[model samples]
Target: MQSKIEKHVMLTKKLALSAVIALSLSACGSGGSDDAPSAPRVQNITYEALPAMLTFNEGETVRLSLNTKGEGASGLKFNWTVKYLNQDVTFTGQGSDTISFKAPNVDMHSTMQVSVKLDEANSTKTFGFHDQHLSLSIKDLNPPTTPAHELGEEVSEIDTSVLTTGSTWTETHKQNSRIDQVDSSYNLVDSTLIRSFIVESADQNKQVVGTNYCGFPDLNSMELNASVLSIKCSSGTSSTQYFQKENSFSIVQKCDETIVGVSTFEKKSNEAIASFGSLNMQFKNFADLQTKEVCAVVATSKVTAHSADNQEVAKEEATAIRLVTQQEGNDFELHFAFNEAPNGFFVSLNSFFDENNKATIISGSYPELNASSQSGSLDLDAKNSISNMKGTFNFVLKNDAGLNEAVEGDFELVLE
Candidate 1:
């Protein structure tokens, strides 16, 4: 009996051990198959587009474009579509995996919603220009004769939102005259704009460099979008600029930190015009902004006014422009708009793309102004030597008419 019991116990132990081993094997196989890794699932898509606002002067044809990028954006086809003023507009072969858009001169969309779809993922953007009731009422201590001068208390209500707070900007002017370097910066505040800068650069004409700095909350404003930037510059000083179109945009220097002008659009086009109170910024030339960047420079020139009309006045004028940027690279192109100026006044710019892939602008002239009394012998010479080009510039304003005066300055070119 004892032997039989012992045999039964041994047989039971063996059966239990075998069952346990089988169950462990099955569990291991199940875990191995279930936990196998798989490819990542894409998420967090973002959308971007150009011409944040499209402006059409009633019956004017308009163009629109769309661009997008994000996770899960690769190796996928796209569908580009638009809804303009309740109308459906579509474009074929207009979408791509990375970058795509509808060509220029497409249908006009007074109000628009644009969409891009790619393999189970999609994004959309809204584009339109609304006629805003913008009013400017701030009385200028010294006003120019234009719609701007009529701007009274209405100026107070004007879209100050365009001028950002917590935004800062700096400017400088280097010249041969006593006012070698004129420097200043701005800080947007609740009541008035805050600013400060200095002046230097005498005798040593090595290379007069001036810089201007600006600080604003965001890139949204009539001044930044399509308005004139005015400043009061000291007599006999001028400036040129080198800018980071994508990272660093600059403004024309102010003489003694005093200058004012209404930002207006360029004539015929939606571009803005730049003017100054008792001053003029004459843009001589543009330093090739590093490739793939948009640069903004304010150039000012001064001329004596023989007539109060601001027209028919023979004055010595120097030019400068406030330079601004968005990004920098080789695959980038720049489109300019006039954010501020008077109606019918035109603003034009010049750029140079050299053999070494470096760009050098000879100069830009505002060919749309009403009169040219100071156009006698004032010319910017940028076609000289072109080797080992160290960043150096020379500005000359010849008031041979003795009718008015002029000023000039340049910038330090830094390539990153």
Candidate 2:
């Protein structure tokens, strides 16, 4: 029985093997392929370098970047070194696709190098820096402007007011007064005295003669305009003459002649002047103000004795004059004094000098001024002198001042 079973098992195994062989033969016969097509494998690589080059100041921050391009990397790494004066600064990074770092403070211009690697890719970038300092400066690009008038010539007359509202006689003429006087006579004591009266308003014009020469720069090459101011006598002796000739008085910045520069007054008073003061001035240093040496001026109201109606008269009238050198701490200011007369004064600025030494005076219209108050401006150049002051002046009279009649105006003067 055992021999029969073994024979059966062997037959079964043989039958199975026969079936597998039959199947293989049938597939081959049908033209079916035994081998199958396979998909293609792909791989990529990328790399970028950091800071090709850079420049920055000592205190400024330097930015570094890693440039890269690739695909399928096992790992990425970064190694950087800042080399300066044979010294090295080394650092490392891991798994980082890109990185940035600031450069250290270097004494001089320098260059730093960086190296990066990823799988089979490697890159290098160089950063450059230059050290520099910061600094600023100002200067005058042009020469100073010369004075407008010839040397030894008289300066334009400036008008200024005295602050004497509540002061005494000594204080009124000394401290509160904006003007100082100096002359050979009267011990060079310049109280307020008006002279060389030339008043030009709307209808009439006149001129005053002066022989004194001041050493002002001959700047007769600039354009100029004329300006005028009228101040009435507000206080002091009332018998002031209108026009007096051959009268000389020095309008000084100092009460004593120790301080010398002056705008002297000669041939004082005029018939048309009714207790008023007029000043005629030419423009100088009008263009080159920045380069000119400017000074403050004080207008003195001088009372001069004159003849009226051919009578050897002893009368006093106010006139205006200025000093060559400016008074310390005082700019060009206008002051009008009147004894309770409304609109008793009229101050006008008619002209100024341009850059090219020419005359420009105000003529057509007179600027309105308040006779009640004594304050204004005198924009004039002290370095140059003015000689010719021609204008026509008119006045309105008040009843309390004794002479309440119409006063006509006329003026004239010559520069050095």
Q: Pick the candidate with the highest TM-score.
A: 1
The estimated TM-scores of all candidates read: 0.18, 0.17
TM-score quality measure for candidate 1? 0.18
Q: What lDDT tens digits, residue by residue, belong to model 1 across residues 1-416?
A: 12222221221111011111100000011223556964343333333333223333323333433333445434234554554323444444555623222322311111234444433332212112111111111112231222322322222122322223332232232221111111111111111112211111111222222212221223222232222244323231222211222212333222222222332211111122111111113333422333212223332223222221112323232232222332222222111122111111232221121111111222222212111122112122343111101112222323244323222223221111
In model 2, which regions exceed 4 Å deviation?
1-42, 50-52, 59-61, 90-97, 117-416
Give the count of colliding residue pairs in each prediction. 109, 93
Q: Report every candidate's CA lDDT.
A: 0.25, 0.25
lDDT of 2 at 393: 38
Give the C-alpha miss distance for residue 415 in model 2, angstroms: 51
lDDT of 2 by residue, 1-416 (tens): 12221221121111011111100000011223458443221224333333333444444444443433333223334444443222444333434544444455532222333433332322211111111111100111221221223122333422111111221110011111111112111111123222222322211122222111221223111111121112221121111111111223222222111121223333223332221223422222121111112111122322222121112223222223332212222222222222111121333322131111111121112112112111222223223122323333333322333422232323333321
